[model samples]
Target: MTAAQYLNCLQGVMQREWLRFFQQRSRFLSALVRPLLWLLVFAAGFRAALGVSIIPPYSTYITYETYILPGLCCMILLFNGMQGSLSMVYDREMGSMRVLLMSPLPRPFLLLCKLLATALVSLIQVYAFLAIAWCFDIRPPLWGLLAAAPALLLAALLLSSLGLLLSNGIRQLENFAGVMNFVIFPLFFLSSALYPLWKMRESSEWLYWLCALNPFTHAVELVRFALYQQFNLTALLVCLGLWLLFSLAAVLTFNPQRAAVRG
Candidate 1:
């Protein structure tokens, strides 16, 4: 496709996702509520029990809520990423995806546009959660929020790509709930979302290594550092690499022939 045509296709994909997002107001509310509950209720309960030592991106002791705020922000992206994939499944079943794929635009470009549009929507939720956290005094620096935008977007891209990759393998909507449980719970619970890696190490060495190797862990770390106006070369590199790898895999595995047969 020509540059102008490609831009038009991109705009349409984004507009579709944006309209779907607002049309489902409950989806928006639940996305905010899940993390807010963690920030307000769960974090409050754990604040006294969990003592965070001075860690990188942190110069002094910080509350548990403060430490997990980045993770909760990532949580918003994580859920929305999978939710985007769920919509893809629904679209395919309804024949809308086939129509999208039939466009003259290259499949990879079309898929990338879809991924980015979903990431943009996910960022809206992430920032909303961050704003709520700030009100609760779990604030990162104002400048950090600004600096973290690219990091958050990268993380959103990585997770959204991963979600698309998984969805490409799923042939039916009926099985998506199990897939979500298997993917989301393990990725979240096994990562540094709720606790630091060092704390996990104190409990079990193997579990710590699992958290270390999780891409979501790096995503959260990337956000954590960026939220403090700090740069983490390792986290940035990991997230970028995962984003490219997963996006490529998703595009490759998203076979229109197979989808046609299945449908």
Candidate 2:
């Protein structure tokens, strides 16, 4: 497709996703509600029991809610990404996938556009959660919020691409719930989302290593540092690399020709 045509296709895909998001109001509310529950209930319960030290990105001791804010923001993205991918599975079963694949645009470019569009939608939920957090006085610095935009977007792209990659392997909608639970909970719990890596190490060294190895952990760290207007080069590089790797894999797996050969 020509450049203008490709742009048009991208715009159309994004608009479709946006319209679908509004049509399913429950999805938007649930996305917001999950993080709010974590912030309001779960974090409150843990506040007294868990104490955070002055870590590199943090200048002083912070409340448990404050500490987990970035992780929870990422959690919003993570779930939404997988939800977006689940929609892909639904589309496939509904015969819409064939239509999308038959477009004049290159399949990889189309998939990339889908990934970008999904990432953009997930960002809306992330910022919404941040706004709610602000009302509760769980505020990051104003500049930190600005600095977080790129990091949040990167994290969104990383998770969305990973979700799309998983969706390509999913052959049936019936199995998607199982897959989502298996993938999402582990990624969220095993990372430094709820607690610090040091705390995890104190409990079990192996668990700490696992958290360190998790790409989601890097994504969380990228947001964590950026929320404080700081930069974690390691986190940035890991997230960037994983975003590229997952996007490439998703595109390859999404190829209709590959599916035909396998069939």
Point out where model 1 deviates above 4 Å: 261-263
Q: In candidate 2, how many clashes are counted?
A: 0
Find the candidate with the highest lDDT and give its number: 1
Candidate 2 regions off by >4 Å?
Answer: 257-263
For 76-164, candidate 2 gives per-residue lDDT tens digits of 99998899899888888776877788797888888988988999999988988999999999999999998999999999999999999
lDDT of 1 by residue, 74-142 (tens): 999999999989988888877788888789888999899999999999999998888887787888999
Query: Candidate 2 at 144: error in angstroms?
Result: 1.2
CA lDDT of every candidate: 0.93, 0.91
Measure candidate 2: CA RMSD: 2.0
What are the models' TM-scores?
0.98, 0.96
